[model samples]
Target chain A: MKILIIGAGGMVGRKLTVKLQGAGALNGQPITALTLADIFAPEVPQGGIKTTSVAADLSRDGAAEELLAERPDVIFHLAAIVSGEAEANFEKGYRINLDGTRLLFEAIRQAGQVEHYYPKLVFTSSIAVFGEPLPAVIPDTQVLTPLTSYGTQKAIGELLLADYSRRGVFDGIGIRLPTIAVRPGAPNKAASGFFSGIIREPLAGLEAILPVAETVRHWFASPRAAVGFLIHAAELNTATLGQRRSLSMPGLSATVGEQIEALERAAGLDAVALIRREPDAKIIEMVAGWPKDFDSQRATDLGFVGDSDIDEIIRIHIADELKGKIGRGAA
Target chain B: MKILIIGAGGMVGRKLTVKLQGAGALNGQPITALTLADIFAPEVPQGGIKTTSVAADLSRDGAAEELLAERPDVIFHLAAIVSGEAEANFEKGYRINLDGTRLLFEAIRQAGQVEHYYPKLVFTSSIAVFGEPLPAVIPDTQVLTPLTSYGTQKAIGELLLADYSRRGVFDGIGIRLPTIAVRPGAPNKAASGFFSGIIREPLAGLEAILPVAETVRHWFASPRAAVGFLIHAAELNTATLGQRRSLSMPGLSATVGEQIEALERAAGLDAVALIRREPDAKIIEMVAGWPKDFDSQRATDLGFVGDSDIDEIIRIHIADELKGKIGRGAA
Candidate 1:
């Protein structure tokens, strides 16, 4: 099987590449070739498959078309500007997230003009698509009323994915991933970043700030689970999806206190004590608008899986990113 | 108040334009100038306000920007290709319905760069935005999953309108109009034309074909009600809309049997006999996917009204289109 992974330089993309390398195949088919693309070229992974890495900005004219020239069997479109950056720069967000996705879809359609080439396109949408005045638990049928530019862009992408799939341009599946917990990276300025930082930093025997109340809840999935979702989405039966090509993926809903308790279970009191409560009203206000939990019936029924709870999410991070080891300060 | 009406040549547009002209002002403000634009130039109505008529295609590059050059205080963006035409021609649909709307909003935003100009933009969306596997009574929070390309375009327009409105580029309100019953014009090939035709033809003492089962249900509003929605949307306190700028306008839901019964009550059995039952499987399948009813709480609370029932809808047609006259065979 041939594969193309866009935004392959990002954390998830790198992890996905490593996972794919370890598997040596997808959907029981050998990975003969791989094309990895991003704004910054990704490093070639340790794999026997023939790999081509290129730096390309998809929002640029003809960039998407050029990327589709090879026409891989499966396409993983993970490229997008982060929420904070997108909110900061409106035009840049729409250009990269909205226009870029459209261009890619158009390019794929145009490529099939001479011959039938319908690749399985897996798109990464976000839970940001749901916003304020939200239900306590958003159902699969909840309307998308994104309040931020980034959310709006992702919602548009989801709509386009469904339409293009319906038109037979490509077999598309959009997975609305929850906030990835225990993110294996340095803490960022994003309001939601604290969800992961509070857990990740403490586990590393480092101090972390908790911006919101301990009772504040959010939907989460581990990076390992996210990669699994990507693979499953690519392999799932498209016929069952019908008209709704995009779906909210299943996730574990947990409060900040639950997350801390989970960290304590894995790393004991020493790691939990590193967390400091430093309330920031701005972050709290922003996070409050986010969807707390979801009844992602479709994704769950379709065989997609996520971590069971906050404890499982924390364990996955340690297993995957920390080599099954804890910090020296662990109790 | 300077007002601009795009698609002024269409039936609803003409009605709205004439209504505005008759009102002499909007929101108690005097109409100083009116700009009417469409592919075919609309005739200027007899009014004291200065009227400019132009034949302009909004999809054409620079057309939207040029229209905004005048900087009208109020804009009624009612331009669109019909469903059948859009379904048959994919490129035309996206270009006219989606790209045209985007270009118009972008032009308005860019204009604000030089000088602050936020016009009250009343965008005419359609019930086509909702599609198959629909709820018995679609609520205000129903997810937009349009089965047709036309519906997809309109749904996309709603998203853009909300985003643009949120950014303070334009004070925009998108009203998702139900299928306008008793459309006063020549019979067209549109799938939904028969809904209007059955009433229009029988009222005019002509034979009309009922292409679906008597039990076929759909949401509807009169052309007059549609015009009212535009005016009300234009004059509404937009601050109340908050983040959700687009709304599902209130409409009466009635089956074909209910419509025929209402017709029989207004006119005699002779007028009802003018209706010929000739089932078209294609139209039946198409109509089956349409929304049956809606719990348009947002629109109702916002003061956008529609006919109370099928009987009231027929009365609207009589008072507005027929000048309160009925056929000689009336009961």
Candidate 2:
């Protein structure tokens, strides 16, 4: 099975690449070749499988067509402008997030017109699709009224995915991934970054600012789980999805308090104490509008799994990123 | 106030234009000018107000920019490829419905960048945004899982409207109009045309085919009421909409049997007898997936009204289109 992973330079994409290399196969078929494409050429993973990396701006005319020329059997589309950048620069956001995705879909359809080619398309959507006035536990059927431009783009992508899939252009599936917690990287400018930073920094014996109240809850999944979702989506019998191509992937819901509690349980009081209480009103206000939890029944029923709790999420991070050892100060 | 109607040649657009002419004002401001644009040059309405009719395909380059050069204060975007056409020709549908709408919004944003220009954009969405597995009474919060390309385009438009509105690019409102019953003029090829045909053709002393069973209920509003919704949307203090700009507009929910019964009451058994039970399997299957009813609480609270029942719907058509007279066969 040949595969194409767009946005393969990102952390989740890199991790997914490694996982695929380790498995050597997907959907019970051997991984013959892999093409990794992103804004900057993605790093080619060390594997027996043939790998090619290309740097392409998909929104540019003919870029998507060039990528689809080889006709990869499964395509995982995860590239998107982050929420902050999209909100700050409207044109760029729509260009990359919305136009880019549409161009890719159009490319696939055009390719099919020349030859009978239909591939499995797994698109990564986001919970940002749901806006304020959200119910405590958002059902799978929640209306998509994204407050941010990024969210709007993702919602539009979901619509396009469904329509294209229905028309038999591609066997498409959109998985609305929850925020990845304990993200295996340094802190970033995203308002949701604190969710990961509080754990990642503290585990490294560095002080991490807690931007919101402990009572504030949000949905989460480890990066490992997110990659799993992409793979699972690709392998699924799409006939079961019917007309609605998107599914809100199952997630572990936890508050800052619960996350801290899990940290204490794993790495002792030293790690918990490393979390500095410097609340930022801006993040608090923004986080207030974010989805707290979801009843992702459809994804769960379809066999998509999530971390059992905050403890399991942290454990996975340690085993994967920290190599099963605590930082010196925390230890 | 300057007003622009993008689909002034269509039935609802024409009605809205006439209504504006009758009122001579909107939001209590005196009408200064009107611009009517469509695929073909719309026939200029007879009115004291200055009017410009333009032939334009909005999806083409520079078309939207040309339309926005004057920056009309209120823009009613009522243009779209109907469902049947959109389904048959995917490229045309996306090009016209999706790309055209986006280009218009982009033009408005560009104009605002040059100088302050935030128009009240009243977009006409459709009940097609909601698909099968629908509730008997679809709530205001129903998920937009459009089953057709047209619905997908409209749903995408709603997302864009909300996001752009939230960003202060434009004061936008998307009204999801129900099936417009008793649609004036000859019957068209739309799957939902039978809903109007049973009432319209019979009132004209012509036989009309009922392609679906009488038990099949559906949401509706008259063409007059649809125009009213547009005007009301244009005048609304959109602050009440918050992050959610799109609304399921208030509409009457009635079955085929109820419609025929109302026809009998309005024009006796002779009019009801003109309805023929000729169920086309294709139309029946298509109609089965349509939204039946709506709990349009938000639209109602926002003061958007609809015809009270099938009787009022038929009455409005007679008063508006038939010169308040039943056909000779029924009279």
Candidate 3:
């Protein structure tokens, strides 16, 4: 089937595109024609099939319609400014996150009415959709009460997806992802960056700063598991999703100290020692507001899985990010 | 303090406006001015309280901002096309219900930033936010998975209220009202009109048609209770609401059989027999989709009240609607 991957230059989008472009990609149904879109043109993948790279601001009135002229069978929407950036810039966030999404859906809905062109849309949401005063372990059924602009925007998107999907305008599924642990590449402004940075930097012999107390816990999933989630989401029959179209996904809940110990066990004590402890009030406030654990029974039953422990998570990161070349403080 | 009541010509809006005019209608402090707006201007209430009526489409740009220019201290937003109308005209539903609500919030948020003009907003939501396959009785904590366009609009409004409230941009509270029974009016297009029409028309010596099975149950409140819920929402402090700002109000659940019995016991056999049975498949399908019961623990704990029974509800209608002289079927 023809497919479009919006925001193909971002972290999740890049991985998902790579996974889809690999030889024998998408085990069952192969993607026939591929279009990769982002604010900036995406790096063209060379898997030998048809591909197009279109760079344009998605919030523009007819950008989505222009893309839909290709009539992709599947669209993976993995765009949006990150949580910190969105919270800080109100207009930009709402423009890109909320209006941009609506434009795409409206384009799809209108196109489908004219040309019978409904496509399976997989939107990547986040646990940020839940806010503070949460149950120690948030249940799959807790009402979405987002605290930040980013969270609120995501929650709004989820509502729109369910409504649009229900109206037969299109088929859509929103998977609320957990924090991707040991995220490779350089750290940015994300408050949750330390969650991955502490492990990633130390593994590469660079000392990493810990922003919050080691005892503070959070939910985590490997980037590999995230890719798996996208594939499963694309393949799952949405008829079983019923009315609750947005679902909490499964992941491991571990504290920073536990993550450190797992890193030490995997990469040895020298690598663990490269972790430095520091606290910023701003990051601490942001981390304190995030959900630490969830009772994600729905996704588990729906056949999504995550790393059993932090060790597996670290191993996956090393295998993916380190490229099998052992770092300075390796085991 | 200036207050605006949209949908003032509608049942709930009229009742709320009348009560506020009768009382001083202090929202946390004092009321200095009031504005009631709708598609048609509502009849002016007695008692000398400064009031203005505006008839303008909120779906248009700058309308909400223009309305907020007066800088009302509290805005009672009781506007919308109801269930049947919303479903009948899909475009109108999205345009008025979804886009109109968003534009109103944007106007409120913008006004709030100008010299700190945040106003207390009371939004009327509905139990239609819940669909079928309910768990015996739905709890206040149940996730919203609406099945219709009307439900989707209300759910989206609730989310926006929460998000806007969280920003400290405005103090907003959404009350999810049950179907108002003994609704004092001529039956329009609402399928659930039978709930009130069965008693309302029959008592007025006109034949009332029953469209669904006696076994089909639904939750309801009297028009008096609806006005009370709105007033209570305006009076209550939302600091206690935390992130879950929208609440499922307490209500009484009754089956059609129970309703007929209550009418018989209250208004005699003549009134009961004025009801004609004509099972409608369309209505049966529609009513079948509604929720029968709600846990309502939060609303109860928050001190909101509903009709004690169908007897008191009917008595309220007789005293309030017929001025206590039940001409023909006085039991």
Which candidate leads the pack in TM-score? 2
Q: What is the C-alpha lDDT of each candidate?
A: 0.90, 0.92, 0.86
Q: Lowest lDDT 10-mer window, candidate 2 chain A?
A: A322-331
Number of residue pairs clashing in candidate 1, backbone atoms closer than 3 angstroms, sequence gap of 3 or more or interchain? 0
Worst window of 10 by summed lDDT in candidate 1 chain A: A322-331
Q: Candidate 3 regions off by >4 Å? A: A23-27, A329-331, B27-30, B327-331
Per-model TM-score, in order, reads: 0.97, 0.99, 0.96
> Local error of candidate 2 at A162, Å?
0.2
In model 2, the Cα lDDT at residue B296 comes to 90
Q: Give the Å shift of residue B222 in candidate 3.
A: 0.9
* Per-residue C-alpha lDDT of model 1 across residues A1-331, encoded as one tens digit per residue: 8999999999889988888888889988998888999999999888777889999999999999888888899999999999999988988998999899999998998898878899999999999999989899998888999988888888889888888888899999999999988788788888888999988888878899998999998999999899999999988989999898889999989999999888899889999899999999999899889999999877889999988888889888888777777785441
Best by DockQ: 2
Worst 10 residues of 3 chain B by lDDT: B322-331
Residue-by-residue lDDT tens digits, candidate 2, B1-331: 9999998988899999999988999999999999999999999878888899999899999999998778899999999998999999999999999999999998998899999999999999999999998878898788998999999999999999998899889999999999998887788888899999998998989999998899989999999899999999999999998888999999998889999899999989998988989979999899888999999988999999888888899999898888898885342
Q: Which is the better candidate, 2 or 3, if ranked by lDDT?
A: 2
Q: Write candidate 3's Cα lDDT for B170-230 as tens digits.
A: 8999999999988987787788889999988877777899999888899989999999999
- Cα error of candidate 2 at position A134, Å: 0.7
By lDDT, highest first, what's the ranking?
Answer: 2, 1, 3
* Candidate 1 to native Cα RMSD, angstroms: 1.9
The collision pairs in model 1 are none
Q: What is candidate 2's local distance difference test score?
A: 0.92
